[model samples]
Target: MHVPDGFINAPVSVAAGVVAAGAVAVSLRGARKELDERAAPLAGLVAAFIFAVQMLNFPVAAGTSGHLLGGALAAILVGPYTGVLVIAVVLLMQGILFADGGLTALGVNITVMGVVTVVVAYALFRGLVLILPRTRRSVTVASFVAALVSVPASAAAFTLVYAIGGTTQVPLGKVLTAMVGVHTLIGIGEAAITMLTVGAVIAVRPDLVYGARGLTAPLKLRVNGELVDAAPARDFTPVAARSPKKVWIGGLVAALVLAGFVSFYASASPDGLEKVAADKGFDKNVEEHAAAGSPLADYGVEGIEAARLSGGLAGVIGVGATLAVGTGAFWLVRRRRTESAGAQV
Candidate 1:
């Protein structure tokens, strides 16, 4: 949920702002270890894809809808550290470009949606991977569970933040109950999306998925009535650089369809967050977005005759901006990794 400026007191928001800044700083350093040549570019595409998927809000309840949060999906496709950075970039783009999330609430969103979801989901995913059978299917199963749990975990985090700095006098218990209850259903959708996407990528290029790395189980061979370790499969070298042409082009095309064409039929009702805020009276304090006057403020270009063209152009611009920013950040992380590797060599 994108908390607007007046939802939280200024002092608490400022404190969260500091924590968010420090988290990004630490994540930048950690990403150096996780990102490489193949992953760096994919990371950018992940951000753009997430930006796109979030626009397709699915119906969750009678009048409220929800969308994929993408933290678990990103972490499973890439790595946890880089996953955090990727979602952060997407959120940043949505905030500044589309006036979707509040600028002041950036820290809160990152803390709840980025750090909390990635940490919790990845920990659960790794734990499951270690205990389950060593197979690509296991990775897919773990991804499903990870995505299922991450959404409610994020809701709990937001509850905690509200407890700390909530400006409204709403009952905490009701808020928590509603938030978790609605988000659990949303989590199922998140799981399905993550599993399908991760499964597809792994099927095509398992080498690219960090969670699926080292998928081979230890080989058992009998030597003279004694079990002995069998020779391993050929060591997998990082695949040669090829254009991300297929996946990137497909993703861009899907994004265009969702935001450009399908969005016209998306429910006219407010999403879960807006519905909750209205029911709870927390929305009364939301100030107008600073970019409310921007041509793309409402996800449509001004003076455009056709809704399709206006929304399509805005989506294209969003995709371009998100990819540029995400790729630049990941490239920096990959460069750092290269430098560190050289120094050690």
Candidate 2:
């Protein structure tokens, strides 16, 4: 959920900003280990994909809807550190470009949505995967459960933040219940999206899906009429290796299609957080976004008359920008990793 400005006071918001900055800093360092030549750009695609899917809000309750949070999905597809960075990038893009999230509350949104969700989901997912069978199915199942819980965990995190710096007076108990309850329904949708996305990637490119990395056993061969495990193939490339460009192209196209066209059919109802805030009367403190004058504010082009065309153009622009920024960020991280290794020699 994108927290708007004025929902939280200045002091706590600044505190959360510090926390968000620290999280991003740590993730940048951690991502160095995770991103390689192939994975660096793919992680960027994950961010763009998350941005596109988030534009398609599915109905969760009669008056409420929810979209993919992408914490578990990204963490499973990529890794936990990169997942945090991915969500943070998406939130940053949405805030500055689309004016979806408030600039003042950017830290709050990142803290709750990006940091909390990734940490909780990844930890739980790893635990589950460790306890369950080491198969693709287990990875998918763990993804489902991890994603489902991450949403509520985010709700609880926001609640805790609000408790400390809420701008308006509201019943904390009711707010917590409503936030958690609606988000629980939202979590189901999150679970399905995460499960299906992870399953699809694992099915085609288990080598690329970070969570499914070790699931595949070593190739077996008949040696002297006896079945034996083959030697580790260092240069043995998987399906994704045949053409990494194709996968990136396919992913970008899917993201472009979803955000450009499919989002038009998405539910118009308020999302889980907005619904809860309105119901609890805490929306009263909401302030106008600082970037409300941006050309792409509210996911629509400023001068485009047709709602469909304007929205589609904005979505396309968003995807392209996110891809560029995310890819560049990861590329630099990868470059540093390479440089570090070279310096060791």
Candidate 3:
């Protein structure tokens, strides 16, 4: 959930800001190992795709809706460190440009939605993949389960944070139950999206999926009635070299279609966090967004001829900006990695 300004007390938000800053710093170093020429561009596309999909909030309960958190999806598709950076980029763009998330709360959102989710999901994904049959199906299944669990884990993290620095007097018990219960439902949607996307990428370019690496297990060969493991597959190239150009093009087209054409049919209901906050009284502390007067405020272009067109244009702009910012950050990370390797040499 995109926590706007004032929901969390100023001190708590600042603390989260510090934590978020540290996370970014560490992620920059970690991502050097994860990103290369190939993953650099795909990382940008992943951020844009997350931005686009997040625009389509699906109904979870009668009054509340949930959208893709994208950390698990990004981490599984790319790498965990790069996934954190990608999501951070998307959050940065949404805060500064679309005013979706608050500027002050950027760190909170990134920490909860970006860092925590990636860590939890990636750990679970790796654990499951290690135990399960090393097949594409297993990878997809693990992705689904990892994504499903990560949402509730994030909810628990928020509750812990709120217990420490909640702005309101809401009971911790109520907050935990509501947050976990609603987010569990949201987790199912997250699982489906993560699984489907992972499956699609694995089907087309298994080489590019970070989680799918080394999945081409050596085939068993029967030689003179004795079965033996065949030679292991060669490590032709790292993940970044695998061109995701086709997947990227297809994703861009889908993003445009969803935000441009399909978004017209999306429900007008407030999302999960908004609904929960309103019903539970936590929304009272929400201050107005800084970009309240922006032309694309509220995801609608001011004075546009049609609501659909206005929203669509805003979505497109958001996607493009997110991609650019994400790509720039990732490219720099790659450059730093290259330079560091050279220095070591």
Candidate 4:
């Protein structure tokens, strides 16, 4: 859920902002190892894909809607550190361009939605992977469970933040119960999406799937009627790397179609956070977005009469911008990694 401004006081906002900044800094360093020339560009596409899917909010109970948080999906596909950066990019784009989230409350949104989800999902995902079979199916299964739980985990985090600095004193117990309960339903959707996306990618390119690394067991050879581990093949080239263009292009096309056309059909209801705020009476403190006057405010272009055209254009623009910015950021991170390796050599 994208939190609006004034929900939390300035003090808490600043504190969260600090926390978010620190998380980004840590991710920037950690991502160096997770990314290379191939993965860096793919990470950018992952962020843009998240931006597209988030627009497809589906109905949940209590008249609330839930959409993909995408932390688990990103961490499983890319890496945990890069996943945090991915969500941060999506949040920044939404806040600034579409005004989907409050600019002042940006830190709260990033911490709640980005860092918490990725950390929780990746931790649980890794744990699951360790216990399960070393197969592609197992990876998707882990993704499913981690993604499902991450929603309520994020909700619990938000509840804790609100308890600390909520402007309107909603009963803490009531808030916690409602937030966690509704988000549980949202978690189901998140799980399904993560599982499918991870499975699809792994099916085509397991090497590109970070979590699927080492999933392929050692090649077995028959020697004296007994199976033994085969020696490593030298000068091996991964077939997946050869078709980077296909994966990137296919992902971008899917994102464009989802955002440009499918978003119009998304459930037109308040999301989990908004529904909770209104029901609990804390939404009274909500303030108008500062970017309300922008042409792309509220996910619609200004002066566009047709709902379909305006929203479609806005979604397309958001996808394009997110892809460009996300790619640029990861490219820098990858470059730094290359420079470091050369220096060491």
Candidate 5:
């Protein structure tokens, strides 16, 4: 959920900002090891896809809707550190370009939606994969469960943040209850989308899926009454020999279709956080977004009378901008890794 301005006091917001900054710094260092040639470009496409899917809000309850928080999906497809950066890129773009999330609340949104979700989802996903049967289906199952839990985890994080810095005097128990309850319903949708997307990727190119790596159980052969380790797959292709361009192009096209056209049919109901805020009486103090006057504010192009065309154009622009920024960041990280290696020579 995108926390608007005035929802949290200035001191707490600034404190959260510091925490967000530190997390990003740490993630950037970690991402250096994760963003190789194969993953660098896909990471950007993942960000754009997340940005697009988030626009297609699905109905969760009466007058309430939910969309992909995307931490689990991104972490499953890419590495966790890169997943955090990808989500941060989307949040930053939304705040500055579309006026969707407030600039002042950027830290809150990133902390809850990006950092907390990615950490919790990846941790749970790894744990489950280790215990369950090592198969592609198991990976998808783990992804579903991880995504299901991540949404409520994010809601709980928001509750904790609000308890410390909520502008209104809403009771903590009520806020926690409502937030968790609504988000739990939202989690179902999140799990479904994550399972399908991760499953699809695993089916096509399991090699590209970060979470699915090493998931295949080692082969066993019967050798003279004793079991022995079988040789590795002979058909396996080297990473350097494979091109990610096909997957990248397919993913980009899917994202364009989802945001440019399918988004028009998304539910109009307010999302889980907005609904809870209104129900809990904290919505009254919400301030206008600082970038509300931007041409692309609220995912619509300025001077475009047709709702469909304006929204489509805004969505396309958002996808392009997010892809550009995310790719640049990941490419820089990859370059730094190379330079560091060269210096060790």
Candidate 6:
């Protein structure tokens, strides 16, 4: 859930901002090991896709809705460090451009939605994959379960953060219950989206899936009375042969479609956090977004009168901007990695 301004006091907000900054710094270093020429562009696509999917909020309860948080999905597709950066980028863009999340609350949103979710989900996913069979189905199962757990984990994290810095006085028990309960429902939707998206990528290009890598069991051959490792294939496909551009282009098209068109049909209900705040009487302290005057505030173009067209254009613009920024960040990281390696020699 995107936390707005004034929900948390200035002291806590600034503390969270410092924590967020440190986490991003650490993640940037970690991402250097994760990103290479092959996966750098895909990381950008993952960010754009997450940005688009988040716009399509699905109904969770009668008046509550939730959308894909993208932590698990991004972690499975890319690596955990890159996943954090991807989500952080999305939150930054949404806060500054779309006014979907408040600029002052950017750190809170990134900490809860990006860092916590990615860490918890990736840990669970790695653990499950190690114990389960090394198959695509197992990977998908792990993705679902990890995503399911991540949402509630994020909710719990928010509860703890609020307990420390909530602007309004409220019963901690009720806040925890409502936050966890509503987010648990939201977790189902997150799991479904994560599972389907991870499954689809695994099916098409298992090589591109970061979580699925090293999952294929070594081939065994029965020779005489003992089993022996099978010989490597002589005519395997080369990395160059499987160009990422195709998948990149395809993913961009899908993101554009989801944000620019399908988003119009998404539920208009308040999301889990908004609903819980309103119910718990803490919503009154929420302040207006700093970027509320932006042309693309609330995901609508400034001059467009048609709701459909305005929203569509805003979505498209968001996708484009996210892609550009994300790709640039990842490419820079990749270049740094190359330069570092060369210097070692």
Clashing pairs for model 4 are: none
Question: Against the true structure, what is each candidate's TM-score?
Answer: 0.90, 0.94, 0.92, 0.94, 0.95, 0.95
lDDT of 5 by residue, 254-328 (tens): 999999999989999999999999988998899999999999999999999999999999999999999999888
In candidate 6, residue 124 scores what lDDT? Answer: 100
Per-residue lDDT over 1-345 for candidate 4, one digit per residue giving the tens place of the 0 to 100 score: 999998999999999999999999999999999996557779999999999999999998767899999998998889999999999999999988888888889999999999999999999999999999988889999999999999999999999999999999779999999999999999999999999999888877777888888887556899999999998767466654565787889999999999999999999999999998989999998999988888899889898999999998999999999999999999999999999999999
What digit string (tens of lDDT, one per residue) describes model 3 on residues 1-345? 888887888889899999989988888888898886657768888999998888888888878889889999999988998888888988888887777988888888999999999999999999999999989999999999999999988888888887877788887798888888999999999999999999998887887788998896457899999999998778786655666778889988887777777776776778767877787888777888897787877788889978878999988888887878888888888899899999999
Worst 10 residues of 4 by lDDT: 235-244
Query: Model 6 over residues 182-228: C-alpha lDDT tens digits?
Result: 99999999999999999888777788899998776456899998999
Give me the runs in candidate 4 sitting further than 4 Å from their true place.
217-236, 239-241
Residue-wise lDDT of candidate 1 within 266-294, one digit each (tens)? 66667666777788877778888877787
lDDT of 1 at 255: 65
TM-score of candidate 3 versus the correct structure, residues matched by position: 0.92
Ranked by TM-score, the better of candidates 3 and 5 is 5
Q: Against the true structure, candidate 6 has what lDDT?
A: 0.92
How good is model 4 by TM-score?
0.94
Model 5 misplacement above 4 A:
217-236
List all candidate RMSDs to the true structure. 4.0, 3.2, 3.0, 3.1, 3.0, 2.9
* TM-score attained by model 1: 0.90
Query: lDDT for each of the candidates?
Result: 0.83, 0.91, 0.86, 0.92, 0.92, 0.92
**After superposition, candidate 3 runs with Cα above 4 Å error:** 217-242
For candidate 2, the per-residue lDDT at 276 reads 93
